[model samples]
Target: MDDARPPRARHRPGAERWFRPPDEERRGPAGTRPPWLSTLLVTAVVLIGSGFAGRNQPQRVPLDHVGYALLCAGGVLLLFRHRFPRTVTCGTAAMTAGYLAAGYPYGPVFAITALGVFAGIVGGHRRVAWAALGGLWLSHLVLAHWLYAWLPPAHDHAAPWGQELIVTAWAVAVVAVSELVRVRREQLAKVRAERAAAARRRADEERLRIARELHDVLAHSISVINVQAGVGLALLDDDPEQARTALTTIKAASKEALGEVRHVLDTLRAPGDAPRSPAPGLDRLPELTEQAKGAGLAVDVTTEGGHTALPPGTDLAAFRIVQEALTNIVRHSGSRTARVLLRYGPRSLEIGVDDDGPATTGQGEPAGGGNGLVGMRERAAALGGTVEAGPRADGGFRVRARIPLAAPPGRATGTDTVTPDATEEES
Candidate 1:
């Protein structure tokens, strides 16, 4: 079947430029028209007032067909004041001037015009609103003079200057009210944006902290498991007793790791609940050395100077730093013997971990790719502390950290003092 219509042409690039949909069209679906309906209601009120004023006048100006038409036209223009505020303001002002000049009775037309001007200013057409107000004021002055000079004075008693003053005051009030509303809306929007940004930042920080906690718990436990597994495998046939001991070490390490991981998870799941176990601190150094010995590493602990109690956060950070350092020594440094030194000063605590082992690589990275050193630095820096880690001149790795002893704000220093037991070797 042959059709009379021509074949459709293919669309070219930028073809939509000529037929782009308007913003209103893209939004789709019209909502309720309550605002426009309210404007129509206001216009009706003005029309009724005008009619009533014209009928009740003792010396009526006798509005003819044209005068009545102008009065109605001015009120009608106000129906669209919100949608086209500037245009409605000008149109209503012109119609009101015509009605007044035609010797029509003064009515509610001026009220409608004021509403239009207010809408224009609130709609962000301030210049147009000001211009309309000035034009209306000037028109009122000229019209008042013409009425007094040409027509016999009726019941009008107000002076022209006084009338103009009242109208000017009304216009100024409208402008001030609109500007206050605009500023208040802007301030509310700014506050909402700032609150949202703060929430996002806090969320990011919490996620990072959780990631660091998981890494610290898992890395140390997994390294011990790896070493014990190797020992168990090597002695499985030749020495069952030693293999069993190695397996026991592995079991204990895995159990402790599981407990720590569960604790972290519980804290995340029920943040309002009290923690099931207290966080490990420097007091648990002996237990940590025992675990390291089980992983086939020898550790020596030494202490010097006064041991003052630390803030909870600082204490936790110090313990994590040492744990991460030792985990690195076990997994990366091929050292059998490691040394830990703790020094307490008047205003700071110094911690040192040195191992007589070959560096994993020339760049001083641990065996497995990890962020242990970066985590150490972050922990120290959070408490106004510093850390240094690198290869030593004696062909081994050394990690040194200095944490300030300043108490946290609003907290008193603990009265309890910890005295470190001199050199203790674990193998």
Candidate 2:
């Protein structure tokens, strides 16, 4: 059984979706119904309204197939409004103008053309929409005023001048509303783009923060482990007791490294959860000196102006800068001795780390050649501070940082507060 139905009678798969009305086409976050309902509703309204309008105006030609076809064409053109806005606008306007020039009743046919104009303007075809609407109005003026007697149902008179004024007002209102809608849509898109960029920036900063934390923790701990491994090997047979001590240092350093690394990783797993342990600050200088001793680097710590409460951010940055400076001395400096000086003023804390060096690696440049110095600078700068590191004129390498302490009167909201130990140390 071969199907011999006309091609238009056959239903093409997904054809309904392709030609759905704009109102029925569901946009993201602006859900809509199927196109068929709007199409049938609008087409029915055009047919039924124009039918009634034809009876009221007996001087106009009675509603016929041509008039009904023109009304339906206006609605059909709207099916392509989203995809072919300019085409829909022009086509609907032409159909409306033809309906008028044919002496068919003026009714809901204009509504279809207005919908096309709205779609065109919103879809970034403002000029095309304006031109389509203007051309249609101009052709109507020509037919109704000058060509009326020759064009339509016998002996037609010129349309009222007031009707032209009403048409111009209607066109302006439509354009104004459409333009407003377009501007609002553009603003919403811009806001979404800005939010996405901000999220990317925040993610990048978090990545950098994690890298710096891992580098500082691993570099210091591994440098100790490396030094102890060498000492353990050298003293293994001779001074077996000294070798045992070296191995002990290795175990402790590895444990601390694991703890800090785990702390950093925890933030990634569950952000906003309170840390299991408090962050290290200058109060932990004695512990830092102990770790340096295991690496064979003797660190001398001194403080001026006594101790003061520091904002958590400034405290963390200061600790990291000093820790990284000490780590570099242990790994790269030929000198075994290092000096740390912390001068706490009323408004700022200045930290200095110095090593009398010829670099162990003989690279006369900065330590590690990694992002160590860069990380230090970033931390200080984030705290509204600065870091200066260079080979000193006095024949040693020096690193200096000045961090501001914009402390609050009492407990602060989100910012870190003065710890209990800091208060007791100040006393």
Candidate 3:
């Protein structure tokens, strides 16, 4: 004989979904546990306390089978308080009223009712909790009046009005505590969200800064290599000596670029390695101009107003702006001559780069659509400075930057000091 039973429901990958409450009734908030565990704990305590108190009642009224059954059912219903808080609260309240009306002994059954009310309020059901509380109050009033009429005259220990006042005060206290907890949880959640957003913003800024640094380094070096390679190819058949010289320039430029790129990459690697090379600054501008000259641009450098100290960050930004301007001149400007002017004022440093090349649509426009200018502006703005780039009326392009000398508040004035180089790169 084949035994037959309904086929067991298939347990799929997300089988737990079958047991989970609806999304709306799941929990108090995101990242919190479902309230089932807490509800079960509360039910256990109330059930045990009711049993103990029922045994200790002084003026015990006989509890019939129906009364005992109602008490047990009320305790079990508390297990679903979080999922159906209002319904559970009202059900417990009605059961308590029925037990008292049937002349069962007073016990901790009211404690279970109070737990339901608290659960309802904390589970975000304020209106329903209030309604349940009202219904409970009315039921108590009727129960109290009925007992007064039915009990022996000498056995009435307290006035029904005074007992009602005590119960009302207890309900108010539960509501107040639940409201406080809810407000605190909400505040903590808001703070976490703000912290996450701030972290993301900082991460984005750091990424942009890294991208700008990589672009400036690679673009300048690659443009020099490109020009030198073309020169080598052009002179290969006509002037072998000049062609060899161009190849040498390409080799040196590639080596320096690779070193700088390696230094930057090492910073992202694990610590405990050799100390990093010093970052390039104003002192490196002469070498920069020489490299530009090797790539076939006639470069001139001039200084006025005397040199002054600068913060490391400001020094780095200034060097990068000039480097980017010269790179643009070599790659875009048709003219072969470029001039760099450095003016040190009492409160600021002015850097200007101008190339004698006609302004054209794509000429002097940084590759990838003006990201170079955007990076330059971001760097200057971070140091409370400004940069201007445009075509001169006479037909060439000029880029000027003004950086404040005064250090920003709370900024350290230590190892980042800028000093003028005693020797310049030979033309």
Report the lDDT tens digits of candidate 3 across residue range 161-185.
Answer: 7777887897788777767665654
Whole-structure CA lDDT of model 1: 0.71
For all candidates in order, the CA lDDT equals 0.71, 0.77, 0.71
CA deviation > 4 Å runs, candidate 1: 1-159, 361-369, 407-427
What TM-score should be assigned to candidate 2? 0.84
Compare the candidates by TM-score and give the number of the best one.
2
lDDT of 1 at 374: 70
Each candidate: RMSD: 14.1, 11.6, 11.9
Q: Distance (Å) between predicted and true CA of 344, model 1?
A: 2.8
Supply every candidate's count of residue pairs whose N, Cα or C atoms clash at under 3 angstroms: 0, 0, 0
Write candidate 1's Cα lDDT for 251-297 as tens digits: 99999999889987877777557778887789988878988999988
The window of 10 residues in a row where model 3 has the poorest summed lDDT is: 418-427
The worst-scoring run of ten residues by lDDT in candidate 1 lies at 418-427
Clashing residue pairs in candidate 3 (N, C-alpha, C atoms within 3 angstroms)? none
1 or 3, greater by TM-score = 3
Off by over 4 Å in 2: 1-41, 366-368, 407-427
